[model samples]
Target: MSHNINGKAAGKFAAVEQEFAKNFAERGEVGASVCVSVGGETVVDLWGGTADPATETPWERDTVSIVFSCTKAATALCAHILVDCGLLKLHAPVSEYWPEFAKNGKELTTVQMMLNHESAIPAQREPIRPGGFLDWDYMIQRMEDEEAFWEPGTRNGYHMVNFGWTVGELVRRVSGKSLGTFFRDEVASLLSAEFWIGIPDDFSQPIAPIIPFVPDPKMELSPFTKKLLTEPQSIQALSFLNNGGWTPNDPEAHKAEIGGAGGIANARGQVAMYEPLANGGSINGVTLVSAARLAEMGKVSTATQIDATLLAPTRFASGFMKSMDNRAYPGGDQMSAVLGEAAFGHVGAGGSIGFADPDHDLAFSYTMNKMGAGLLLNDRGQSLIDATYAALRA
Candidate 1:
């Protein structure tokens, strides 16, 4: 467990640095970074350990990681921007933009339903061809043709994989640009954020390869995990695993904008995106949305519903996940990311998280190479969160 955990924190935030080191010392963190910003100013930025465990390459200050569903936050931001521009409406039917989405009983599905995971088209019934994830048109076409798993607004399910394409396509149809391109030109480039919805083939960032978790010998699967693992046809499994249940480790595949899962950023870059949302909807003189829209984005849209996909009580606000203390968070382990009731953000699989607590004017992000089991914040990331909030109160 001997590794160099490198980074610095401002005077009041030394505890975040200590917790970042403890992740490696006590929580099996092979390589990771945690970043926090208050009032849009970075107070903590840290990175350490091996980018490639196999190669033992040091995780440098600029090292990035593939943040799975955390990409949803970035994708969701695009939709919100379109809403701000009046090109998309949250309550409008999907047919308002993408007519194809209206097929197979989805005529009543609204943009809000897609954002909050209530669209009931969590997974495609049509078999995904090998490499279907790389084919944006094919994936969306399948979703367009499939029947809703339930009536659009009746059930709340985490749309594990389809979220990107479903919502991404909505952004595309309205903005006249693909989600990745819109994110680059309008969001990332605008904020000078290093986040990428899709990693280009020739991109130069040093991306840490994700190391899959090794199961603990003494640990047993919870009922939720057991269902997802043993029941291949279950909505949870089908939504996540049916399309090969694989994440692209190479640059080419990473270039595909999967929306829900395909996002690449260091903690700093992720925080940059949230910083604007946290700070009256502007950063560095750029406004992504107005204060009015920011408040709307933070309003709770779904709460304590037993999610059909994750089979847990989950909360979401608009396209953002709410910081709820009562439910077992999405990944079958732990409580929510500690934040103000007014906070919102998204968590990726294996411990990456990006969130904004507008009440505190705070934005936080954590990324790691070593995969942790479950969907919510693991100790490695959660410790950093706890320390960040503690620093805020001080």
Candidate 2:
């Protein structure tokens, strides 16, 4: 079932169209969309493939999909906006806003610590029921009482699940609104993008369910990985995938408002949401943040090195992954080597990706419901990114 590509400026991205058709035919992509906006103009907006695993419904242009960790980039944007307004400070101790965060030797942890995945506060001691994530106070209290897996700011570990609660609490404390509310009012409404930190009630019918990948018996986490999960903080991170975290078994689970991980949007909506950042915090006439703050987001707060917990080398910025000279994101090495060192955004667990490339004045987003096999960016996403860059050069 193929969906129509609507909106103006569609023909300029023939390469992206070719790639989308190729992926649907060759890559087993269930349902997906890829959107690219350059210099405030949407050049590519295409969506197709099947919306459900059963192939009963065609993927609609407005069909939304859960973006998993890609939601972090939007969450980061909320923090950046607060910082720009002087409502929050990036370098100041997080305890200044949310005093309870000072517990467990985290008094010195700053917003940079949470953004860079260095706060060492990934999970809570008490397991949360899948639907209970909406209770912000309970979640924050759990993190406040939980001990750090490693000393704060000592090393980098992916704050997998808790990154949202940690930062969202700060946003709430300072703004008197939850992160989701702030994003909807400040960012999504302004850009006319449908992205959501906590999905809204009206759009519930359009969401594609998350399909988890089958575990490969041959691929196992190393001994270090075993030890990492044993730590209290580590278990909390892994719990996200358990019956508690974003699993599809619970229908009401999608409604839970987990800021860091539970965001949902289609490709066009995701790209539109970030276009302001690519255009220096203003797209068209709307300015979400100032140019100075956007510059701060692109600067590297962490670098390519062996991650403390994952025990694998990864390149990272404040909340975004950096493209290294030797190894670019997932499959970027063989593609055009044109990605600026300043590209910033977040990649989801399976294969979804969204980012703002300031160098190219582009904001690109790709999302799919079908879960892929590998940990890093999956083949479908990498191929689309490669093809997009190839088209730009041509």
Candidate 3:
């Protein structure tokens, strides 16, 4: 059934609206929102469907959901802001900012190395205390104690959950504020966006609960997912599932500052967060970074043949994802994130995504509680992105 869409799309963006409707009819979108801005103007903003399937509560104008690793972009932006302000050095040893991080063979690890996933500490081999993620000091101690997966600088890997603490510590140590507060004060508050790294216990907003992924026996699974199921000792398994009692739907996770993954936002909030990056790091007189820093944020800092964690080809720019076209490789079509060469952002584990394409002067985001298959942008999000680009061409 085609659900009644609740927002408007510009005349040129009719194509986007059609695909948004198609997501409900042809695709299996349960509850979702998509927003796009081009030339500093919001061309499309739309949302529909049930927020809670059990109650059948309809998704409203301000509903938000956990954006997962899309929060990484926000965390990364906080680190880069410090770089832009001369408080942190991009290439300086991370030890310079936080001396304790030099422990366990990480003396040479740099800030950029952490941003680009080259810290060589993908996951800790040991188990963390139950509910350890919520305790910032405990997670910081874990970072200092975790051994390197490979010799630092010899190879790179996606830090998955640890990325928040690894990079967030720098933000905290240098800025005298937690990662979430830095983002709010420096980025979200300035842009008037509704995104949050950590929310309050009394946060009254209705968050659409995320639908968990159900494995299908008939479908081909990713190498990472396969290993995650079979080899319990593998890094692929550890990197993703080693969370110390932090589940996406858990109420505590919503209030904790898990910047690597835990983020809450809707499509409109994401677009507002990205608009400044798309428009040379400033929107409405709020400058988040200099032009040089903006260029560095979008530049491909690392492109790996096969990511150690995902077991797929990946491309990263500092902390954001670049256009990762993996269609030519086996089982990579679903894992790819197709965008302009100049685009940079992060995709949450589910179908959610938010990015800025400077080449097109575009900022776009899609968020949903019902997740599709694959670790990257599933059809629900990719279709909306394709539609946005098609409108730009039109």
Candidate 4:
């Protein structure tokens, strides 16, 4: 299957582009795009392969798909921007903005605590209402009624999907707009980034539907998956399988602001979105935060030996993921996302990712329709990250 790869790779980045195309040959990439920007310049911008393998639809430059948790980075950016504007304080309790959040042992939950996964609203223990994700009020009410998994701020837990409503609700309360609208009117609109937290009903663009992950039958279950299957009452099970009848492939899901796990973007769109953060918080006169705030955005705020929910080592910088080097740990290489030491971003399920490395003045993204095994960056996306860094050093 010699799929056509279209786009440009300037200078040394040509090698990076080659690696992107090679993914189809050596790796199991079904359809994907990789984009890179260095020192505020787009040195590599490429998209290729099929968008819908079932229909044989060519993966055009504009093709987009669900970026899953990568959407967390965008949601976090909206919160931090409010911090930069003095509209919200990082140290302020979430109750300051939404008083209802103060109950259920969350009275002291600070904005930073929520962003760093230290506030303990990791997931709802009971089942959510069917398709409750689409109803903002329903989700918020559930959050209010939910109890903390542990003493808030005592342990770190990857908030997973709930991050959207926990932090996103704060964005809405402070900014007086929905999470998707705030991100668009303030962030995406500024950079002309095509990424969207929630697509509107009138949105006519064709979205590359998500291909669900299929695990190998021969593969051994991880501690997380094993626990999820055996202990259905555990947090791990609740965090994953308890979604309110939402499927990524559904058009209605695309139109809802599931900011934690539902974002639609291509590599170019993600790269463009992170461009300003890599370039000192402003580009083309579109400023997201000041240089000082950008510094805070990239700094690691929490490190845990085993995240309470994911049951794995994790590091978080506010709402973003810092460069995670878990390669030395047992089977950690498969779940690690290694970027520049100062880089901060998020990886979605099935290996889509976007990040900004301020130390290198670089922004990068890889979006794909096909699913990959593992909880983090698979070889398909990590290879591109390595190739991009190699090109940068050249």
> Mind sharing the TM-score for model 4?
0.98
Candidate 3 structure quality by residue, lDDT tens digits, 96-164: 998888877888999989998999888878887899988889999999988888877667789898899
Clashing pairs in 4: none
Name the lDDT of candidate 4: 0.89
Better lDDT candidate (1, 4): 4
Q: For each of the candidates, give the backbone clash count.
A: 2, 0, 0, 0
Assess the local accuracy of residue 17 in candidate 2 as a C-alpha lDDT between 0 and 100. 78
Which candidate, 1 or 2, has the higher TM-score?
1
Better structure of 3 and 4 per lDDT: 3
Q: Write out the backbone clash pairs for model 1.
A: 164-260, 331-375
Candidates in order have lDDT scores of: 0.85, 0.74, 0.90, 0.89
Q: After superposition, how far is residue 291 of candidate 3 from its true place, in Å?
A: 1.3
Which ranges in model 3 have alpha carbons more than 4 Å from their true place?
none
Q: Residue by residue across 365-393, what tens digits does model 4's lDDT show?
A: 99999888777888899999999999889
Ordered by lDDT, highest first, the candidates read 3, 4, 1, 2
Candidate 1 off by > 4 Å: 326-332
- Kindly provide the TM-score of model 3 when superposed on the true structure, using C-alpha atoms: 0.98
TM-score of each: 0.96, 0.88, 0.98, 0.98
- Candidate 2 accuracy as TM-score: 0.88
Better of 2 and 3 by lDDT: 3
